[model samples]
Target chain A: MNKKRIAIDMDDVMTDAIGRFIELYQQEFQEDLSDLRLPGRNLTNTVPPERLEAIKQYPHQPNFFKDLEPIAGSLEVVEQLHQRYEIFITTAALEFEHSFTPKYNWLKKHLPFITWKNIVFCGDKSIIRADYLLDDLDRNLKTFTGTGLLFTAPHNAHVTGYTRLNNWQEVAAYFLH
Target chain B: MNKKRIAIDMDDVMTDAIGRFIELYQQEFQEDLSDLRLPGRNLTNTVPPERLEAIKQYPHQPNFFKDLEPIAGSLEVVEQLHQRYEIFITTAALEFEHSFTPKYNWLKKHLPFITWKNIVFCGDKSIIRADYLLDDLDRNLKTFTGTGLLFTAPHNAHVTGYTRLNNWQEVAAYFLH
Candidate 1:
């Protein structure tokens, strides 16, 4: 039998891209643009489009990916789960073609254990089919027909009525056991 | 001049109480008690009151806190900021005495570097005062008069118009820099 497939969200589920964007935006603009949303609601909108577009064009920030801290125990969990499941990253940053490349590179660099073939970047996650989907967004989770594990993100704490895992350790334990 | 004080939330901010409770309840009851809140409201009502009451009395799950993973970079950032500011944990789990003790003990044991005197456990955060408050709830943020750094929680992603930080590294850089 084929191993079950698991799709994971990127922004908050794996990397701290949203966190870094806000830091850089605040430094350059002297304004906190954390509340703004991207064209789609899946990703964090910490910088305005005009500024974000510009920032994207600039050479990737120094140690941009290396600085990104994975959600606690994410690396270990992914490593363990890889033994039983085919892991793929389904993110919503499709519009920014090259924007997520650095992030992908960072993920590859940091989580050398995860194969590059498993990474899938797209704006709409509903298109993907998997046995399990781990995401922080209710919309994404609702769209997925699989066993959805809602990663308890700070923003989504208000959301109720779902299987919520606050840390990667719980997620790992949930799947492994 | 007194340095600006930092107010941090406890339940999801520092401790994985919600996650722990769910995991333990599921193991004991053999039922998936995932959602904690009611369908439409932020209040926890998904788990029936009778079940919640019973679940609450179960022996404190020591491994729950022991196995918890901190929010990415939260400890390092908190420690770094402790050098310049009065890092105060102004959490709101004090209404239930039973719940508060374990959460407090978990944080105290995991993060011993934080001063015991600086920790403030209360039922409502609106009653507290601070220079800057890092919280995951929009309601709590709205109540505070100071600059509220809405921690970019997964659910709160839908809510807009606030300074948000997705992880502790960005938070530390935001305040320290």
Candidate 2:
């Protein structure tokens, strides 16, 4: 049987971006983001307008994506998934052009098991062709024609329709079965 | 109705890679390649053993892809197609990791009309899902599930199966009809 091509998101799916971004927000302003993850709407409303502009630039900052720690159990679970599925890291990196090299490097360093050839640095998720897309953003999953598996992230706490894989363990459970 | 997504190759289709590679071959080996473009052959057979090693390094060389001239009439023709169809540039750049920045920069410089969001830097062609694919390599076009249009390059002179597009003008005529 042909292996299912699985397109996995990089930011919140593979890395603890929310956890790190909150840490950064705290360091930059000394104010804890207590309710940004709470279900509502509009990501910009999560922070003050002044800090929102600065926070938007965080993904482009040098070493931001490079130094990020992996989402817990993602390494092992993804490696296992890689063996059975044709896994591709389909990431939206156009907004953060500077994040391209660092994100690529981070993937190379951390997820060494996945083929470098399978990594896709794309601007739009709508162009991705896969059997299943595991992402954290509702914007990405919303228009996807294939199976959309929302890998739970703080930003998408209240999304509907797509099956939610709460974590890497959930991902393994969903696919492995 | 949803517009058909058209996938186009980067090297010989957009930029004059065939001419540039030939020029590089002469400068590096001081000899003309007689018949490397002939049917049923390997690309390495075009040069001597030593130069084959050098040729392998050509794609990774600085400014190799960045300095290439756009194919005659490609910019206008692609722009026309882009308006009617969802055009995505599916390029194989993983083999030449260093070529990523230059290739992306070259696209941005020359094909400013094409959205940055539509550009796809990928290693394999089989991953692309589109209604039509315009590529120069027989290897890539051969495996594509879509309607592959062979964008003529010297290397694929004798391959068969896909419809042949000798130039961008021919590409325009094919889709415009």
Give the candidate number with the greatest TM-score: 2
DockQ of prediction 2: 0.62
> Residue by residue across A47-136, what tens digits does model 1's lDDT show?
455565766643254444445667678887888898898777666543343344455566667777655445544444544557888998
Which docking band does candidate 1 fall into?
Answer: incorrect
True contacts kept of 2: 0.60
Compute the lDDT of residue A168 as modeled in candidate 1. 91
TM-scores, all models, native as reference: 0.41, 0.91
Interface RMSD of each: 22.7, 1.5
Off by over 4 Å in 2: A30-43, B26-42
Task: State the lDDT of candidate 2 residue by residue for A23-124, as single tens digits.
Answer: 888898898875655655334978888777788777777667766788899989989998899899888765666677777778889888666678887777
lDDT per residue, candidate 1, B71-158, as tens digits? 6677778888888987777655323423334555665676777644455544345444578889888887886767898886544656
